[model samples]
Target: MNRTPESLTAALDAAMATLDEAVAGGKARLTPEEIGHITYIGKGIALIDGLPGVRSEELLMLGDGVQGLVFNIDPEQVGVILLGDYGALGAGDLVRRSGEVLAVPVGEDLLGRVVDPLGRPRDSRGEPVCHERLPVERPAAEVMDRAPVTVPLATGIKVIDALIPIGRGQRELILGDRQTGKSAIAIDTIVNQRGKDVVCIYCAIGQRSSSIARVIEQLQRHGALDYTLVVVAEGDDPPGLQYIAPYAATSMGEFFMEQGRDVLVVYDDLTQHARAYRELSLLLRRPPGREAFPGDIFYLHSRLLERSTHLRPERGGGSLTALPIIETEAQNLSAYIPTNLISITDGQIYLSPQLFQKGLLPPVEVGKSVSRVGGKTQLPAYRAVASDLKLSYAQFEELEIFSRFGTRLDDETRRTLERGRKVRGILKQPQLSPLSPAEQVMVLYAVTQGLFDAVPEPELSQAEAAVVAALGILPDIVRTIEQGETLKPEALEALLAAARKAVSPLLGPEKVADDH
Candidate 1:
């Protein structure tokens, strides 16, 4: 029952069939000269996303490496989407490997600035004036026959030290909900690593501009700007760009890592990065999963983060530590993405907004957060103090919960409760101040040893923070304690004496500010 069209329709129909076959399956080998110069326009190489579309019937080179191909139709003229290595091409790019895939470069310039997936400067600073760029997803550092994580990675915070301490080449995930200081924890870690011979990369994906800016400012304030590299893929970036952001940052981190140097990369939050992929998938007509995210979402994140690792002993003894943050909606740790991260990391620092509001800056839930890798790399001093740290914390939690029942206990029970209360106070600090590792150990030991029992139950919080502040512990303290060294009992006692002496005056009745 099909009606025949006029003479012109016959020729058009014949051409369309040829176009379809060539676009979908025909072999089209571009000459070496046609690589990097291809036009980024969709007409040249149509990308319809998930759905297959019209085929390219013919190809011609514009001589400057620019490839002009005839497609049955253009797919909305969207800009080119890089699928893979850009380094193989140069300014006079050719199309020999037509889809070699444009990628961002990794190098020394990445420290302390925000960048996009394409490795272009997303901070509006123009293309990074860099010495070089590298492809984003490279291989993992050598596996077995590898050196252990001997050095520590300090975050300048007390709780992280006394518990959940990080080590070089560790893959630690920072999991939390919004406004719980996830990024803050990451930045603090980077800033504190300033002089530790570690190169830092901060990759920001789908974050607000203001928030990204604040990250840079924090680095600058801590004098970590020069040594830190920033890679940003903000919320305004195109879907394609956002999808590639973390890989670009990884590439930058790998540069330092390969040279036998320590490298730390923080993918500020992978949730948005995954969202960007889902958007791209929908646009390309790919199937959606439960969250409308691509089915390979887990693989995508794993591959990016897996690139960070400790190398084999024969591989220059290099390492890449990753701190990939995940923001769970409504603290839904059971969600696919959250669970995926919780499993991938060696450990997690579970930040809670509820605790932060109650004056826990890092707000780490010591019970929920743990390093599965054990204290393999903690400084000896840190190890010693941390052994009893958790026990003390558990006691504090149990006693506090029991006190809530209002069943008055014996005098000894009340004293134990008061001591536990003081320990919690010592760990609390203002919004940004991070402690020295020494201070962390001292506070941990003091609280666990029942040294703070006399500080008064109500003033525990402020009194706890003062012990370190007055002694000027931190920055230098954690390092000395963790340097694979030892200390005599006398020396240890001397240090504690100094911290106690510093806290005594501030623990008086008129020292409300010290306790607060």
Candidate 2:
């Protein structure tokens, strides 16, 4: 066992040969990972030094599995928006680059499920079965890849569908003061998509849990949850989550849109989303502009909304329609954020607090609400019946205002005011009750033709309900209307006949005598 110089040399040479063989075989390769340390931590954000190779919006892992996004990358350090509970993280904690941008799970499994911005299930439904993951921030479809929005997206609300129509692939703004039925309109639209083969995604950013629960309950009650996806970012969630919520939800919708399916995404209100981004930007020391918002606030929403468009046939011919809700301060439409959104979207559906106060449900202000592109997408039947409806209603509004001064002296003006009241009554709809296209056409035809003018104002609702209920006997006429055909003379006669019969019993003797 005594070692000699020659024997030691022989053993050392053999060990060197083995090491070279392992290296040449690629079995001993070295893997270098970049790790950094948090230099400072702020509310929902952290400044990290080192890891100079991190990319903007890249996902990073902090201490104890907390995730962060690289927001501001400078020579000295990078600002990260924390995505999880950062309470466990402190300055000097370890940070590792995930080397990937933030992505969310997207697939059929998301239907009927409630998830967070990170695609984590919050509905206690266990892990979602997602077969694919898409980056939260994706470039929109090219201009050539988009198609004109010719198909109508019916909200089943008589007023919206007949007057302020929404088309597939349109970006429609729903804005109003608080407690003015803005959310009600959006939910009704979602519920209306129950049998329409449209996939709906309701992204609630910075909303109360109870409010979100009520929405879910309504969707479930109407069986809309079957094809709907609820993506929630509660008010208590980190600002980062709220900021990325709509993008993640849009990514989820894009999956279906690319599959030749129509998708509807509702950003319950972008006010909070903008606020969340503002908070993050200020904390990260980004330059602020008007209203203390970052300069890119316009781009922030534009890019998100631009993702919704109708695709060309070669690109699967699908579409993503957006209903972005915004709350106004004291009904101010010219405010900074409201004006920006008004300029971005295709049209605005301005709800009126005055109308709401008057017990007009949905409370959509006809004068302020408009659909820029939806006019081209309305049904032929609507054009035949409601073409002059909007103009007449606007005139009625003007005349009614003047009449309030007790200055009305003309017979025609009095009749116009009376008709306007009846028109408003017909447009008033209950929550969760969406009308069929044929039914909407039926009721619209009745009012536009002055059939409801004979019924007393209080009896208008019953008369309209009776007209809708009596539609079953006019199956052929309903079919014709729903086929998007113009209402022929015979069809109009049939509609009027059925409507008159249904409304006659409800009319009082005084109303009947006045009509005669």
Candidate 3:
């Protein structure tokens, strides 16, 4: 029954008197809807004594506009929370529906604003124009189709770009220390997608208000917020909101992907998100495990991150690229949370704070990261560069380190060191710094060719140009090769032959050899 002001007022007076009596006399009984109604006032919810349909004594939350989240809703007797204390809640709040759902805005006006889980603008910009609304409540996962990831998502991080590349529908985890640039990398990737036909959803759960604000400002400055959706659940929000923030963002991303638009969904950090679930679990009397987290922590991450996938071609042919960030304490990645995430993702871009301080923006440790699904999305030119880049770096690194102590190094090792240095220099961009696709391909070629070796003194522009000029010639060479495969050695050789003649004067007479 819909409530008018007078009727709701009468009902409230009666309920308030009853609740006061219960608080004073120590006894009260009510039905689930009544309990749902009462929980908006503040006692944490749970399955109470012998309640027929009580799901759990979880907290109930209702924002000003939408339907509230009530866990155990019983239609009988209106189960009531007598002394409920909804912090900052007014007595005038009415229960809408007993559903834990929210709406998604579909209009273009939201292009530049940062929003929270409730879809409220956090950017201080203005209200977002709504086009469509969606229910936050999800049905069971049985009917959903499972699909593999095959589309490329250019994060523009070197180690990740070369070794641990992510496909359109891939779930790529970024695990690292507090100051290791995890969130920055995710944000940069989102910003980089501005001109591309991609939508970005950034979910910030249990993050500091200041940090969240900074992210919003960063997105706004870069104009990435225009094409991105920001879903924030701050550190002070109820645990329930933290648990649902990512889901709300993912739903928004899925909506676009279904319409044949690509979506990049970044879970700013899931470590706190998982902890929030564990907090609620413990509060509800669930048993804890090795890390004092609920046993289902792994499953929660798996299910959430797995939601990013290239839907089967028959299903609109769009994709959701997932980049889930995990914060590891003291850089101990062996912790239960990091391990659980590592197992669930296709690959991880492990950022080291030590490297970040050493001036590496992405700080991605190539040796520590590996993409298991490499064959799925790597283009021929990219794959060719990646395949040999690692070996060269390793060979160069060993020689360079020893040579620092005055040891003589082999020519091959010296060349590798120069290449490695150029690679490192190129990767050292600022946090949340995004590079263009053309820029990525250009530098990629610089590494492939030993351009670093011939530079008596490497100028940034020179290195950048050498790379762009190399990549400018790839389309003509790989025109006949199939997508998702590396360019053939013979094809590459022909390109390199012309490249040598073209660059001999500009880069000088350095021997460029073909890998046989």
Candidate 4:
């Protein structure tokens, strides 16, 4: 027999297989493990000197079960950002690769539970019952896989729904100075999602414990906890945890979105998220740019926000709507981070500190805020009621500013100012009390139709409440409006009649008859 190389190689393989089988019953197989040692330790990061094959963003285990992320891979040393307590870790500590990237538990079980960025239960409840895990970083859906945003995500805030509307799958930025009701809008939006079949995830990054508790309590009190998930990375958490919090929350929401469910993920102020990243990047020796932020700062948010979109019917027909909040300083929208976010989002809802001081609960500056896609998604009834509303409101604002100089005005301008005041009054809603679409339309219709012009400005809230209460009697009209249909002439008349009857006592017969 001619001993060919192929036959010889096959014989050698067979001998090795027989030897392995012979020892399988009595001996265990040994596998190679790559271990590195921390060469230096910083506040929330460590430098490792081994693990030549370690991948960037891969999870690493350090002393005492502390986890770290491979933030930078260098020829001589690797930079790892510690995700947990680093006090127990020091130089020369052993580090082991997890052989996987950073991931968090995701499933239906996570809903209604308060958890940290790592998906560990933070509530009194036991461990989360999730059966699957997903990586914290995911590529966004391709354009071909996304559908046009056609459905409205009604926030139930009259000003938002009437002027600065939000559409499902749209990335709408909520930006304002501190204490300007930025988070309030997001929370109210979540509260409004109740019974709308929309799953909400609120990611609190670098917020105070008391603030987080307050938010959770609000959700519970409103029964929104049943459909909402809270992901918290408190202000004192490690910078690494804060940096990854929103991404982890987004992954959790993506799980539900893939299941054909509409999901809303609110990043409560990414300013801290950016600051956390800046800290980590500076520690990792990455070069900083304007505002001392890493050059990839814009890319960081663009990538995360790009993941939110409406998937095609074939892909799931689900949508992931993002309401990422950003905090500004001294009402400066031109700041570095604010500008980046404003350019990235489909539109922005600018909350004015000035308006907030004036006791506007939402403080949404309509002139500065806009909705690029929501107009197409708004209901036909809303279109009819607010077609000229925004323009008229803008005009009133400019005129009011001029009138502040004590200039004498004509009857027409005075009437416009009065109507505008009524409009503003009707838009002022109390916190935690979100209106339904039907109720919003009713009150908005009354204001836009000049029915509220005669009503006393001091009694606007009471009159608006009366109109909302009267909606119960016009169930057919309510149903029609909620169904997104164009309001019929008779339905409009019926709504007008109900509004007059509801506010007659407050307005008096003469005031109510003035409308005719």
Segments of candidate 1 deviating more than 4 angstroms: 1-99, 112-114, 123-131, 456-466, 469-482, 507-516
Inter-residue clash pairs, candidate 2: none
What is the TM-score of each predicted model, taking all chains together? 0.78, 0.95, 0.76, 0.94
Runs in model 4 with CA error above 4 Å?
Answer: 1-24
lDDT of each: 0.68, 0.93, 0.67, 0.93
Tens-place lDDT per residue, model 1, 414-485, is 877777666667666565566666767777766766557667656666656676665454434445675666
Tell how far residue 326 is off in model 4, in angstroms. 0.6
List where candidate 2 sits over 4 angstroms from the true fold: 1-26, 508-516
Q: Candidate 4's residue-wise lDDT over 1-516, tens digit each? A: 699999999999999999988888768679999999999999888999999999989999998799999999999999999888888788888999889999999999998999999999899999999889999999999999999999999998999999988999999999988998989999999999999999999999999999999999999999999999999999999999999999999999999999899999999979999999999999989999999999999999999999999999999999999999999998888989999999999999999988999997788888999999888899999887788899999999999999999999999999999999999988999998998888988899888888888888888998898999999898888889888889988998899889878878887767756756
The TM-score of candidate 3 is: 0.76
lDDT-superior candidate, 1 or 3: 1
Candidate 2 lDDT over 440-506, as tens digits, reads 8889988987889878778788888899998999889888877777789888888888887787788
